[model samples]
Structures are given as structure tokens and as C-alpha cells.
Target chain A: MGITKTQIFNEEQNDLAQFFKVLGHPARVAILQYVSNQNACICNDLVEEIGLAQATISQHLKELKSIGLLNGEIEGKKMCYCINVERWETIQNQLNNFFNKTKSNCC
Target chain B: MGITKTQIFNEEQNDLAQFFKVLGHPARVAILQYVSNQNACICNDLVEEIGLAQATISQHLKELKSIGLLNGEIEGKKMCYCINVERWETIQNQLNNFFNKTKSNCC
Candidate 1:
């Protein structure tokens, strides 16, 4: 968790928690959904869509990118951002594995 | 996004965010795992298993319970906790719906 006690748990648990941590904010969820629904990646559109300032939107985008949940490129004068499909699926699998592993018949 | 903007996002996104927020901690993840793998339930075992103090483990357990991912019962002197199957299935479906909604082809 901190510096010395990180090794007790395996990598998968840590990675899954990180993904969830990045997704803990509503703004990030809105950003991801807006990007996912668009035919093309929307950069500036998010500022308007989420009703947040440009800087706040950029901060959320950066957090999403930190988890590899998104990718962006400079398109003409602006940057276009979209979901990282491979990473999304990777996270999907990770979450699926975690949820599916629970037998849950005990209580 | 703040006091005036809570209505901007729908209910599902908010609920999803809450779940992610609770699961953001590795200690909580470990606690859930330890509870899930047992046949009955483990309350005090977690203190030893996680190697954390009693108060620390209780705090994590409270967070997990608040999210409805766990259920506990007062069994004599100690309490026994286990995964809430119906709620687990509910959250599993929620995560699945969120993930499966993404078309994710055009990155």
C-alpha cells in the first residue's frame, strides 16, 4: 500500500484498484462515456459536454490517460481524445475476472 | 459538477462512481478477497490475515459494508462477515453493462 507493504498483495489486485481509483470521479466517467459514444475522439467537446472548465477537463483526461484508459493525438489545431480500446478491454477482463471469481453462495 | 451540478449526470454513473470510490483502496480489495474465498466467513481472521491492526481492518470492513458488497452477522462474541451474493451479482451486472456498452472499435 505504502512503500514497504506493497508486496503482500499480487499485481492484479493492485492494478484493479488503480483502475477503480481513476474511475472514482464522476467527471472521469462522463468523459469516458462522451468519448466512447462519439464517432471520433472529442477533445474540446468534453469541456462543453461535462460542463467543466478546460483545465478541469484536461485534468480528468490526464487521470484517465494515466490508467491507459484513453489516448489522444494532436488533430490539426486541437488534440482529439478517445478511449484506448485495448486497455479498456484489458480492464474489462481484469474486472470480469475479479467479479466472476466470487462464488458468493455462502452469504 | 459541484453543489449546483449534481443533476448533470444520471443515476447509474453516480452509483458506479461510488462503487469505484469504495474499491479504490487495496486494503479493501484484500479484505473483500479474504472474505470471498472462505466457506463461511472471517471477521477476526482478517486482522491476522491482512496483518493490520484491529481498528484499521474494522475501518476497511465498514467501507466495504457501506457499499453493500459485504454482509455481517453477530455470531456470539465475534461477528462473521461474508460477501452479499445478491449485491455482488448486482454490482457484477452493473460493471458488465458499463463495459459492454462500449463499441470500442474506432480508437
Candidate 2:
């Protein structure tokens, strides 16, 4: 296999790509949507809500948290999860800017 | 590895998941950004602009086209590409709705 040679890309390109890469998983998307729907911090219910195994959901949660999109607070033996609103708004604006910028350009 | 059994999820869940999955690749993200930046219909410059091999860029283009994010017009041996405005707006609204809905829900 040939090496990707990702070094040729700019940091902004790579950073933006990494952000999208985290969003690429179906399980993660479902988890995010579910969490978004929940609105309040959720604990122990993701497995039931998302229909994935606990391990799978946990892994997805970890990915979301890694991106700072989700936050968790330990309440006893369970961890309550909710969207980090500040990060959510940041991401939304970033995406909106990216998409809106496209509208002005044509070729 | 166990089978994912995606059949268990709702159609809306699956559709939304597929959209994000398509957005997950760095190459695809770069392609979208490049196309957005170009503003004019880009034909053969991608290999130069993004600095990926022809086949690699072609594969990435196919993925974006598959998702209806890009439109291509074949001119002789080359294909000119641009973002499809209507579909772009549709996807933007869908994503906006998904995120906005999350803000309204709790627990």
C-alpha cells in the first residue's frame, strides 16, 4: 500500500478533515442524535436508546467526547452525558460557514 | 467481529447516519472545501490543487458525488465539478434541524 502523504496538506485542511472524520461513523451519529434529543445529561440509557451494545455505545461516546462535542459528569457509578453547548455552537457555525461559503462560489 | 445488525434502527436514524458517514473522510472534506473555494467549475485542477494522485482524487470525487454534494459536467476528456446548490441546501437544513432539535430536548 502506498503511503497517503498527508503531510502535503495544510493544517487547516487536516484539522477540518479530522473533525469530519469523527462525525463519519453511523454509530457515533446515532449516539449524537440521541444525546441531542435527550437535551439533559443522560446516564445508562444510551445503550437502550441507541440499540447498540454498551461497549459500542461507550466507544462512540468516547469518540464524541474526544472531539469535545459531548461532556460527561460522574454521578456515583454512572456518568451523565450531555452536549457541550459551546462546542456544539462552534461546530454548527463552522459547518454553516463552510457550506455558506460554497453558495457564493461557482465554477 | 459481530455483525452490526443495522436493521434494528429506524430509517431516519439510518439515513442521518449515512450522511455523516459520508462526511467522515478527510479526503472528501478536502474535496468539498476545494470545490467550494474554487467557485468556478473545476475540471482537472483537483490533482494539482489538492495534490492527490488522479485515482485517489477520482475515488474521493465519486464518494462526494454519490452523496449528491457535488455536480459534474463532462467536457471532452474532462469533467467539470461544482456543488449542487439545491441538494446542498437540503443537507444544510437537515443538519440544522437535527442539531436544533437536540437543543430543544432534554433527558
Candidate 3:
């Protein structure tokens, strides 16, 4: 893959693309949906809930957390995870802004 | 990379992920923005406008078109490109639905 010329784009474009890139994988999307659907923080349930291996789930969770979309904590032997609500809202608004501002004008 | 377990995910999850994956690249996002900002179809200008090589720009355009976000046609010598308005609206709604339905309940 060619190196991305991220420097050529503004902050909003780069930031928005990063968010979308992290969410590009189905495992990450499924993980986000599962965690967000829960009433409280979840621990060690993702492997069973998403039907992926523990390491695989951890990798997906790591990707989501890298973007600050998921908040996680270590509780003894288990690591608990939940949505980072503020970050979620911020990303939602960012996406909305991109879509709203870039309304197409041509055929 | 492990093969994505697409079968484990529902249609919505797979569809949304594909959209996000295509938009994940900054070059693609820039291409879409440039095309949408234009009042008419753009042709041969993307290489200059996006500061990418002709081949690189074409690849990115292909990815955008693969997701149905871009409409393109050959205008004699130059290939004209524009946003697919219907597909854009549908994707916007899909993103909004995913965000709305998966409202975070914790942390």
C-alpha cells in the first residue's frame, strides 16, 4: 500500500477517516454493538457473545479502545469494557458534520 | 490477517463495515469531498486536486465507486465523476441508524 498523504488533509478529514478506519472491520462493529447493548460494563463475555477467540476479541477491543470509543478496566482476573459515551457522541457528531457539510451538488 | 468472519455478522453489520472500510482512507475521503464539492462532474482533475499520482487517484476512485458512493462515466477522452446521491443518502442513514440504535448505556 502506498503511504497515505495525511499531511495534505485538514484535521477534520484525518480524524474522521481514522474513526471510519477503526470501524472498517466487522469484528470491531460487532464488538461495539455487543458492548453498547449491555446495561453495564462487560468482562470476558465478548468471546462467547461474538463467537471469536479470546485473543481475537481482545485485538478487536484494543482497536476500538485505541480510538477511545471503548472504555476498559482491569478488575482482578477479568478486564471490563464499556462504551465511552462522550467519545461516542463526539464521533457521531463528527460523522454527522462530514455528511451534512458535504452534500453533493452534481449528477 | 485472519479471514473476517463475515458470516457471523448480520447484513447491516457487514454493509456498514464495508462502507466504513472504503471511507477509511484519507485519500478516498478527500476524493469524495472534492467530487461532492463540485457543481458538475469532475474529470482528470482529481490527480491535481488531490495531489496524488494518476494511478493512485484512480485506485482510490475505484474503491469509492465500489461502495456506490461515486458515479462516473467516460466523457469522450476524460472520465467524469460525481457523487451517487441516492447511495450517499442511504449510507448516511445507515450510519445514523447504527449510531442511534446502539446508544451506549454505560460508562
Candidate 4:
């Protein structure tokens, strides 16, 4: 397929789409859930918690980080990861705005 | 990229991922916004409004329909589409629950 004609859409539309796209994978969703449930940000626990290969989990983690939904820090030999709350709140607001503002139904 | 290990994840994770995946495109976002803003459901107007190719818009509509986010009804010569409120509310709640429930800051 040709590249998405992003210019045709507004900034909010593009931003909302990006927020949704980052959460589009089951592995990523499970990873965020796992990290959020823990009292401390996690490192090596993800591969076991999510039941995915280390490489796969790492790739998912990378995608999550690339989108600013997740943050990672090197802790000696391991990298600890956690949800980036600031970005999460921004995404939540965008999502709520989209869902809550659509009024007067059709069809 | 290998296939996603969907079997490893729970039903809720899969469902949430599906909701986001369907909305991951700017064109679809614009289409939903356009249809919601209109007083009546729409069809061909999307191609012009979204400024995308007919096939691209049709594909986006199909994906939205697949996830129950949109509904289309054939009217005489045109197929009108609109946001599906029931599914929209469900997704909205799911997103809210995910965002609201995550607490306890982590670095």
C-alpha cells in the first residue's frame, strides 16, 4: 500500500491514531499490564510474566518505548521498564476527548 | 517479524489490542470524526472528506466495521456509515478502566 496521506488529516486525528497504534499489540498490552501491576518498575521479569521469548518481549518493549508509552533505564546489567505516566495521561485525555465529544448519533 | 503469540495473552488483552488496531490509522480517525460531526450517516462523502483513495477509505471502513466501531447501511444508491454507539461506549470504558486503574508510580 502507498504511504498514509497524513497531510489530509488533522493533528488531533494523527495523534489519536498514534496513541491507538502503539497499544495495538497483545504482547505490548500484556507488558504494560505486567509493569503496572508491580510495585517497582521491572527489568528481567517481563519475559517470564508475559510468557514470550526474550527477544520478542524486548522488541515489544522497544516499540512501546519508541512511542513514549514506556520508559526504560539501564540498571547495571538489566534495563528496568515502566509506564511513562505523563505520556499515558496525555493519551488518555486524547482518547477521552474523542469518545466523549462525539455527540448526536447517526445511523 | 514473526507472527504474534496471541495464545500467550488473555482475552481482555486481545480485545483491547483489537480495538486499538482498528483505530490505528489517520484516515479512519478522520472518517469517524467526519461521520460523527455530520447530522446524517455518510458513505461516499468520506472519500472526499478524508482525501484518500476510494479503496483506502473502503478498507478503513471495513476494518472499523470488523471491530463494530462503525455501521453501514445501504440507502438506495449510497451506503451510509456512522459510529456504532454501543461498541464505542464499551471501548471507551475499557480504555478508561485501563488508564484510571493504573496507579503507584515507578521509575
| Interface RMSD over true interface Cα atoms for each candidate | 2.4, 3.0, 1.3, 1.5
For A1-107, candidate 1 gives per-residue lDDT tens digits of 44425566678778778888888877788778778888866457788778877988888889988988888888888988878888888888888888878545475
Which CAPRI level is candidate 4?
A: medium
Interface RMSD of 3: 1.3
Per-model TM-score on C-alpha atoms: 0.90, 0.87, 0.94, 0.93
Best by DockQ: 3
Q: In model 4, what is the error at residue A40, expressed in angstroms?
A: 2.2
Give the per-residue lDDT of model 3 (tens digit) for B71-98: 8898888888888888888999999999
Report the candidate with higher TM-score, 3 versus 4: 3
* lDDT score, candidate 3, position B30: 83
Q: What is the DockQ of candidate 2?
A: 0.53
Deviation of model 3 at A55, angstroms: 1.3
Q: Which portions of model 3 show Cα errors greater than 4 Å? A: none
Backbone clash tally (model 3): 0
Candidate number of the best TM-score: 3
Model 4 misplaced regions, further than 4 Å: none
lDDT of 4 by residue, A1-107 (tens): 55777787789888888888888999888888888888876566888878878988888888989889888988888888888899888878888988888734766
Q: Which window of 10 residues has the lowest lDDT sum in candidate 2 chain B?
A: B98-107
Cα lDDT tens digits, model 3, A22-88, are: 9999988888888878776755688887898888888888899999988888877777888878888
The list of candidate 1 runs beyond 4 A from truth reads A1-8, B1-7, B103-105
- TM-score order of candidates, top first: 3, 4, 1, 2
